[model samples]
Target: MDVWPSLREAAARVDDLVAALPAPGARSAAQRAELGTARDAARTLRVRYLDAHAEMLYERLTAGTQGLRLEELVEAAGAGYPSVVPTAAQLESDRGRRQADKEGHEIDQGIFLSAVLRSPSAGPHLLDTMLRPTPRALELLPEFTRTGVLRTRSVLLERRDGAAYLTLCRDDCLNAEDEAQVDDMETAVDLALLDPRVEVGVVRGGEMSHPRYRGRRVFSAGINLKCLEAGDITLTGFLLRRELGYIHKLVRGVLTDRPGSWHSRTVEKPWIAAVDTFAIGGGAQLLLVFDHVLAAADAYVSLPAAREGIVPGAANFRLGRHTGPRISRQVILHGRRIHAAEPDARLVLDEVVEPGAMDAAIAAAVERLRSPAVVANRRMLNTAEESQDEFRRYMSEFALQQALRLYGEDVIAKAGRFAGRSG
Candidate 1:
């Protein structure tokens, strides 16, 4: 008369049956046929039970017919499943294959529709977030392990001036809960990129609002370099770690090592540039690697190695090479952030516009670079810059300096500053 235990057993059997279907070759003939029957029953249950069909079907299958055995289904599904899960290496290799075969896409049909219906006013932040990462955006990406999402978004629009623009937005997140949920918005973005509706490789940042990273956990500023390092093992860490290899491949894909490719040219891709509200420490380092820099006139750009009792890493190398060693040393040693009055003559931006004018400036620059000839000329100039061995030496020296600085008394002093801090 106690049906509860019987139902539980039946559910177990059903789960096994479904799980075993992936490797049907391992099943006995009778078990295979039984699985087919159970599957059919599941289909029927789907239509009949509607709301609780899955649970009902699972119970029915696990019940194991002594002859054909509802219990056998559960046993079969469980037995055929692998014990060891795929490793991060395996998953990454698989993910890369999938990504290379397709393109990153954005899922914005709903957002787009909402924006259209709502007639939302687009601000520069919104536009920047929505814009895709251009080719050669970053030379290196770090790798992390955790549940993650890789998303790409792109939008094409014609300016009123008759110029066509392609925006590639790329944003990724990891450690998301509920993998099966419809709201893994990155999946939608990936679908868009893979679809032939637009040029492949175009990407945009994925959904900015997901329950996991939304509301009470909005991105707060004051996340300085050390805090950034701590969070490397967090969501941002996973995103960076997972995509590091992909970033490398992308750079190699576009800038071949072979002669006469973009890598070998004296200039670089004309439209390649970086514009951001804040590029501090590593962020600033990465941006300086760009051929063109656009910063909000008020955007704080700093290499605060001295402030942190450490040496700047890549930023020191890149900026020092871009400017002379003396200027780079002064900036890094003094923790000199760029003030509003600085000139851009030292291999920085051609001009730094007022905060509101940045978007316009970037748009104008992109328009100019759309020309193939201009891009080619820029590549030649950049290639000339790249050929300087002194710059390469600088990066090497900077790396060494950073490693040494981490152990210095300065680092201890800096650590003292953060000892009692709370977010």
Candidate 2:
């Protein structure tokens, strides 16, 4: 079927609706109506594209790429399609039923997630990607082999005594992550996880060098709302980059020991989080995956995503494991703030140390966790706790819900009000 023409027409309708809106932050009933219309058109466009591409991907996966090279497959699929064609090496590496399973699983995830975002179906697709044994090729890939220091503006990576310290350093905004910072953090985590010199990894927020912060450390204030308010980052962009690209990568790395790809080997190292001050929104969400959490006495954690009208990445899936279903619902649905001093905070935080002694506490914890026995135990625990199928299911739902809420007129209006208050 010739779907491109319909896609183009839908795009044009969306463009027309957008062009009718007033300037950013200038809210009006007319502008709200225009945005709602644009959102509807965008969703329709997304559904059309996803449906067509889903069929194409399924065919490609099932038909075995017809022995075509990766670039050739891309050419065959034609332009304006999804750009997730597997590499020649990836295709060649698959052998027999394993090949079908690998390719089919990847394609299924891609299409299932696409459909979820385009529509609202929470049911899981039947795929054995999670239940199957790890592929031999993936197992053979080097786990941790970094040869040199990794540098980044937003994160500081230091290796000492078989542990790598990854400190979030954007204290000027209390380590609030913008797109670049998110990219930097992801890179830092990857480097630390892959470095053979590192056996365990620790993530913490750095003490602010800015005068206003008075040398205090902050875990994170969450996504850079200022950038969002300035229209520098669209809600879709933030969801894709910060949520899917950044935090999701970290969560996958921690839980499955694998990076965000199916082809990568799992890193065997355990990760620890040291939270100081407050971990708000995405910050608290990040802590949910850590094997151990050490928080300062003054620190408090919150998932204010409900208030902000966004989904906290992976928190819904993993937070329940730590905080139980009821409290997880309360923290997420009711926007409850959890202070380190609260008994419920113990569900998430392993320890709460004196505010000024977090460094010493983390140091001791790190030293104690350096034993081979501890590593083995941690790995066993991780194997028991992590579920790839569950993670994939939660993420699909999150992507859909987050997109709807983030782009909805009500949420945009709420964000604008927040921007006004902050300004």
Candidate 3:
């Protein structure tokens, strides 16, 4: 029997079937399922062909290196839909089966290669060939990226069970400048809150500054607003921008003049804001204005501004009202990190999650806040006799002092030391 002609005919039949299916966006459930089966078959056929051609074209394809750095190409590929990613055991078992099936072939390249063909480059080319993301998985990507600087190069993605998933780049170790990028990122999140479509907002943990720690460069301890600056005093001047001034006006628009914008509401969409991973120092304080707080089980939320020889900006007054005199005194006086379990803790973190459980925690928190019962009656009860007056005073001083404190030599040095990135 002429096997080559038979193989070529079979390959042509498979390609025809693949081409006739509806596009990813339009595929019906049954069509999608059939496509999945066909894709698996096509992948196997590809590996068989490649192995057959290897004797003549192998070196050219691999460029003198080990079998075409498939792993590197997979690393570069963009996200697909989130599927139920298999555990290591499942992948191992699947690989074994493929290897056994290919053992009788002329050359057994590997089962992994037979299972999928991840493109060496990323773009529409890959999307057309690979399985499409489930609608839910596609929804998460834009929501996650809309609020911060998700370095496209660092996005980690996986696909399984007809879905796609994404996480920060695996090698996403933070440097000082990266942390500074987060500060700008949070500001972007704050701006996005003005949009009604957004239900939750976040700026994931990242390096704020690049300073030499003991001996190596590291991300600094707090949000680094330095990147927004143009000159020596530029970061200090960021607050004076009309855009920032608009934030102030928006807050003032609702609650005349409230310290930290706490107890204020915008005419825009309602939202539940959250921060994870070392939401202390400036990071913690910045979040104080949010309507709700969701933290990680291991998250360290605090305010250490006082340790640098300054009070807790307007946070002292706003947070004092939120948690009362005792807890506020503890935070302001000691300049300590507030673990989620502290009694009468300021900001009253609504929920806590274990390390790596931020997504689940965020989902639960957002879902709860979306309920009419939760959003209508805020948990706070104001008691200060001169609440409005005091809040106004604090906002004014907060503006002036925050400007000075952020750029002060002492604060910068402390931030550098904390981030392990020396200024």
Candidate 4:
């Protein structure tokens, strides 16, 4: 569909300005300065263009969700870090990136997501699509129910008698999230919710292979810093996808377009999080949505967003509900670590167990929350606590906040340093 004439003009201008700017590399000192100036000019033009043309841009883009889902279209429009460069190709030399250039483009797409998520007409449809069970999950669900286990790149889904366990399986990185893990994790989540026999859901960490913690289960270390250093993580793909995808599904559940599904309620399951050694950053954010949490005595959790110079997913809005405002501030901004056994951490960790007994404790906790009322109560709880409107508002703002941080000079410099140390 053709867009408004003004919007088309603005978009054309945007393209011309972007085409004039140099690509990511700037070799000489003079070239670096020139690159910075050109990029700044592009940003100025884009933001002003957005201010003048956001609505038409949104309408023009969303008009095609019939062909591409809103999520898919944003990705098609360059919403994240550049696609993964092959390992051998990357070994040659430094990328020398001062900031995430893709983010300048992602800013516009991010705003579209934020806008769609909050629009009364678009929001509901976006929610349905965003929370829809992934294509992979749909493909694997039938086999999953019969076999009782479903595995993905970053998650292990095991269906016991009544509970479906969604275990993070990125053990090589201590269950840290990376670019590929989002879909894997979300697909596993979809199966758990759709499985006819699953009464409740449980998420825990798989055993780690790191020499220091070999064979020991370690709940997530959050976003993979190694991947970040490698420039693999992106604003839309890794960051916003988690918020709108699996994490949201953990609380809001999945919806589908099957016959009668519109009248049928969302297929939500009450979830239990079993924190083993620790839940850091993204891991800690997961805790906020679970109906119950079981943590080992030695387990700790933290959201080191301030230290990492990025937003901590939904923690800024949701952690306060668990830890209260003061402690939430400490956790998000002051880099405070809250061990499972601590008093301040009590609210987030429902029950603490001995490290070796996490499995048994999780089973018991699942049984306790396994009644048919669990999902119903979860919906009720969400209504009173973190309503849809509230979540929508936070995410809408977060979409842009996170994109800014992903491209911040400090964050880029930090990633380069981390890469330097590792290399």
Model 4 agreement with the true structure over 1-423: per-residue lDDT tens digits = 223344445555445543565654424557557555654554454445544444444455557454345446564433321221112122112233334433244555565566656565555556556777777789998899899998777888888887888888887778878868887888888888888799888888989888777898888988877677566676666887788888889888887666766644688888898888889989999999888888999989998888788899999989998878899988898999998788877878888889888778877888788787777777988879987777877887887788777767788777666545421
Top of the candidates by lDDT: 4
Per-prediction TM-score, please? 0.41, 0.71, 0.44, 0.85
Count of clashing pairs, candidate 1? 50
* lDDT value, candidate 3, whole model: 0.39
Q: What is candidate 1's local distance difference test score?
A: 0.35
| Comparing 1 and 4 on lDDT, the stronger one | 4
Report the C-alpha lDDT of model 2 over 1-423, residue by residue, as the tens digit: 656676666655654554565543465777767765654564565556666565455344336422322223233443324223323343333323211122221331233344533332222221212211123213322432433444568887777778888889996788887767865765666566555577778899999876666588888988676655444443333454455443544444422444464743445567789998899988998898777899998899999877777677678878998988999999999999999998999999999999878889888888877777865676566558865455555655665566455445555555666655531
Q: List clash counts for every candidate, in order.
A: 50, 1, 23, 0
Question: What TM-score, to 2 decimals, does candidate 4 have?
Answer: 0.85
For residues 3-31, what per-residue lDDT tens digits would candidate 1 score against the true structure?
33443444345546655544433566787
For every candidate structure, what is the RMSD over all alpha carbons to the true structure, in angstroms?
21.5, 10.2, 24.9, 5.1
Clashing residue pairs, backbone N/CA/C < 3 A, model 2? 144-194
* Residue-level lDDT for 169 in candidate 3: 27
- On TM-score, the leading prediction is 4
Candidate 1 TM-score, true structure as reference:
0.41
> Tens-digit lDDT track for model 3 on 73-109?
2222111100111123323332333211211111111
